[model samples]
Target: MLPVMAETLSQLVADSFEIAWDYLEATGELGNPDIAANHLLDTIEAMIRCGERRRLLLSNNAITAYQRFRAEQPLSLAS
Candidate 1:
């Protein structure tokens, strides 16, 4: 759970992604190829990308930039 100050989707998703990554990285969960965690990462990225687009914050292919570094570049694999 997040603090009251972290009510926004951006804040919650960003913090959850970072915290989960920290735990996984410190415990080698990332190396184990856990699909759940990977999906969580993907979900966070999706939320950020969607939020940005909805808020008209997208520009210069800045939306989901890291997703390009992942799979074969999902142009529109759902928001």
Candidate 2:
């Protein structure tokens, strides 16, 4: 039972991460795809572990968290 639940949760987190990553990529607001990917995965995983099961909600919140993190960093001169 526990293994099944873990697998489901893993799938949920992966789906949420994809949704958030795609949205950010589409917006073209990300300065670094690698950094954004890490942030989205971490945020989504944490949210899932805390009992957030709604896919869209997790994606949206992860996007928002990444945006906030980007905002705090120094402006990058790279393309």
Candidate 3:
């Protein structure tokens, strides 16, 4: 159970980071790519830390519910 929880959280964090990075690139608002890259890295780090804390606090049932909901969602072509 512990390992499963950890793995799920890790995957979620990675997915979030990818989504953020893709969004930033799509917007093309980053005038200074280097600065934006640094900011994105920092944001992802913080998101991971927050996700870890939330994972610890969430109940198994909550996690299961999230998994079910995610599974039910239609796949996006843009992804």
> Which candidate should be chosen as best, given lDDT against the real structure?
2
- Quantify all predictions' global Cα lDDT against the true fold: 0.47, 0.84, 0.45
Per-candidate clashes, comma-separated: 0, 0, 0
Show model 2 residue runs off by greater than 4 Å: 1-7, 77-79
User: Ranking under TM-score, best-scoring first?
Assistant: 2, 3, 1
Off by over 4 Å in 3: 1-14, 51-79
Worst 10-residue lDDT window, candidate 3: 55-64
Tens-place lDDT digits, model 2, residues 1-79: 4545444887888899889888888888666877887789999989888988999999999999988888888887212
Question: How much is 58 displaced in model 1, in angstroms?
Answer: 26
Q: In candidate 1, which residue pairs clash?
A: none
TM-score of 3: 0.39
Say which candidate scores most in TM-score. 2
> Stretches of candidate 1 above 4 Å error?
1-6, 32-38, 42-79
lDDT of 3 by residue, 1-79 (tens): 3544445655654555555545546655333455444554455456466544343223222333333443455544112
Q: What tens-digit string does per-residue lDDT give for candidate 1 at 1-79?
A: 9757536766656566666556545644333345434565565666566664222222212223333333443434322
